[model samples]
Target: MIKFESENVQKFAEACVDANSIDELLAGFNHLEADATDCKTWGITPAEWMDAIKAATAEKIRIWASENECPELLKAIAIWKNCPLEEVEIGGEGDIAAGNKWLDDDGLITFYRWNAATYGEAK
Candidate 1:
């Protein structure tokens, strides 16, 4: 179990309204963890932190889904839930060229193509 400061928990809790489903809720939940772990920032891990975070995520998702009119947030949440962190590139633009090379090496879909797919445009 991990512990989070009340103040930090509040920030993630507040963001729940922006989440539309359980999945979205969890993403926003884990986003907090990622933020905390970011060396450029600060974070707190509450006792039994993981469980508490999951519970918080679930509650927030339920509240947001019921209160907000948009279901897309839920879908976004689903996508976030299944995200492969190992496949994610965490750095900035400075890594673009190398990232591109890695993508080619991996035979993975390019961001351009992904954007096109999102917009229903053929790439």
Candidate 2:
């Protein structure tokens, strides 16, 4: 059962990855799953999980825009700065190389990057 509201959980998950800290990123993913489980307890489906991931990833793009003072992240996700939200995969070689010091290359944070290509469970 997802505890946090869908929107809130997604936003926080995105923030977890955007944050320049591995601890923060892990916390974010953990929170996201917990939140989803809370929702699942009430009967959220795999489709909902996909939706949440997309929404959360899009939220990260918004945060990136506001924080970076640029649209690089948004561009990476192919979202317009002032328009309906859109989601895109994030992370790549650069994000992967930034592991531990940041988080694993496949960490949600890295996977949340605009061009992120691959992802897997954190084990």
Candidate 3:
């Protein structure tokens, strides 16, 4: 998991994860980018900040999946983390079906796909 030394950075990361849309996330990024002092204080470039935010979002999702004991979600997280299939305890076909339903219902399939494509090895 990525850790931010600055509280402001941490808060921004959390807000990004909670954001409902890409536009909202972009707005947050723009706001941060405009604050040169805060950016300098964090001691990271814009690219590094974006990387940190992505890491933080993934970490937050992983934590949520673990807390909820959602195997499908955990599997997705494992894929995003690029862990070997054997390392992730995915349930049977029924679990997979349910997981697919959950992902569709929550409109998270695209989010997972985008996240994995952006940060993990291609399938």
lDDT top scorer: 3
Candidate 2 stretches with Cα past 4 Å from truth are: 1-39, 70-123
Question: Local distance difference test, per candidate?
Answer: 0.37, 0.39, 0.47
Ten contiguous residues minimizing lDDT sum, candidate 2: 93-102
Write one digit per residue (lDDT tens) for candidate 3, span 1-123. 446776667766665566534334434443545345535766656766675555444444444444554545555545654665445442332122222332321233344445546657312
Question: Compared with the true structure, what per-residue lDDT tens digits does model 1 show for residues 20-97?
Answer: 454454454445554434222225454333434454544442333345423343333233334433333322221212
Model 2 per-residue lDDT tens digits across residues 5-117: 66645554454446534334334444545455535553555555444444444344334434443245434333311222233322332221121132232333444542433
- Number of colliding residue pairs in model 3: 0
List residue ranges in candidate 1 displaced over 4 A: 1-5, 16-21, 27-42, 46-52, 64-123
Better by lDDT, candidate 3 or 1 = 3
**Cα deviation of 18 in candidate 1 (Å)?**
2.7
Q: Which 10 consecutive residues of model 3 have the lowest summed lDDT?
A: 90-99
TM-score, one value per model: 0.28, 0.31, 0.37
In lDDT terms, how accurate is model 3? 0.47
Cα error of candidate 1 at position 39, Å: 9.3
Question: Using TM-score as the measure, which candidate wins?
Answer: 3
Q: Cα RMSD (Å) per model?
A: 14.5, 12.7, 10.1
